[model samples]
Target: MNIKLIVLFFSLYCLFFVASILFPIDFNWYNSLHKPSYTPSGKTIGIIWAFLYSFISLSVCIVVSMVESFKKAKWFFILFIINYIFNQLFSFFQFEQKNILLATIDCGFVSVTAILLAITAYKHSKTSFILLIPYSLWSIFATYLNYNIYLLNI
Candidate 1:
């Protein structure tokens, strides 16, 4: 039962990760954007995202299992789900159609999610907070990237 639950949650996380990859399938996607030379490559982004998702899944699983306060993880779970979906959807606003404004707005939401998750994790499970540090940092970076893209395109 426990193993199945773990598998289920991990599977869901991977589904979003894979969706992100395909959702940005247009090679022209990169070509359209005037990116910083320091911007990560597709392969680098893929690997980092995959690794981050794995950590997020494991940390959430641990928190859900160990935390006694259903109220705590419950709200955090909702926010986390919203954040994950928004993260995936940003690709649509960005690559498929190239709406830099919408993409920047989406990144704003992602930034909020990161802070909310960080606070919730810190309150509910100290160890979980560590797991999300990378996520928080990435959100900050992504916000800057999105802003730069919007400025460069428009």
Candidate 2:
């Protein structure tokens, strides 16, 4: 693996963490909300996100290193950008704005985009696709969780 590419992928992954910090979940506010019984604690959430980000970074590194064509690479990069946007949007809605409805919608978009990104990565590298499956699954679960919260609180 190219060290520079790995660094680049990891750097991009770190931006997601930065976004989370910029729009952090207010634990007091969150606790006050009517959350689902299935909701995990903040510590659990942090650990899961750490694993997910590591997997996502690895997948991105594989896809970037294995892409055979510029066209395929372009599509992969575009999908990644879109997915990141939705990811940040989810945080902005859920934590910063406290808009559960918008957050649920954003989570839905994140899930869909994650699946699409996995599919796109699959074309270039199976390892990349496989690595991304957990993140995609987590995104889907998060979408459901967010939607449930919206329904319950409404």
Candidate 3:
């Protein structure tokens, strides 16, 4: 694809994250009460998300640019997008009704998808791989948060 397509793709990626934050959607009803042992404040979350999103955008650019021979690798990007969409849904179910099990499952899927994507990206582009580093680490951290929330709520 062209650079325009790649840029559009990355812009769309950040747009979704922005959409998620703009809404008052919560991830879990239990999350409101259960404090994470290492939960950062809202400000911290914003900063971290901004950084992660930047990394994700660059990695996505590389992925999109490499979409020819790496057609199979495209699944990694697809999964990444799917995870974000599902994550929003997960947050809806979690905050709307406190569905811990379902939310936990969603988190698990997202965590796994991100890790797998990270590996694929690493194998393809060194710059993209480096970009994915923080995202992978954060996914792991989010998994912990999701699991703990489930444990505390259930």
Evaluate model 2: give its TM-score: 0.94
Best of the two (1, 3) by lDDT: 1
Off by over 4 Å in 2: none
Tens digit of lDDT per residue, candidate 1, span 1-154? 5986578667867776655667756776676668777788888877887777776776687678776776757878888888887888788877776778888899889888977887887867788889888988888888898788778777
lDDT of 2 by residue, 1-154 (tens): 5788878777967887977889988888888888788998889888998988888888888876776666768888899889989988888898999999999999999999999999988888899999889999999999998899889888
Using lDDT, give the best candidate's number. Answer: 2
Model 3, runs deviating above 4 Å: 1-6, 18-23, 26-32, 69-72
Q: Write out the backbone clash pairs for model 2.
A: none
Per-candidate TM-scores read 0.87, 0.94, 0.77
- If the candidates were sorted by their TM-score against the true structure, best first, what order would they fall in? 2, 1, 3
Supply every candidate's count of residue pairs whose N, Cα or C atoms clash at under 3 angstroms.
0, 0, 0
Cα RMSD (Å) per model? 2.1, 1.3, 3.4
Q: Pick the candidate with the highest TM-score.
A: 2
lDDT of each: 0.78, 0.87, 0.71
Candidate 3 overall Cα lDDT vs. reference? Answer: 0.71
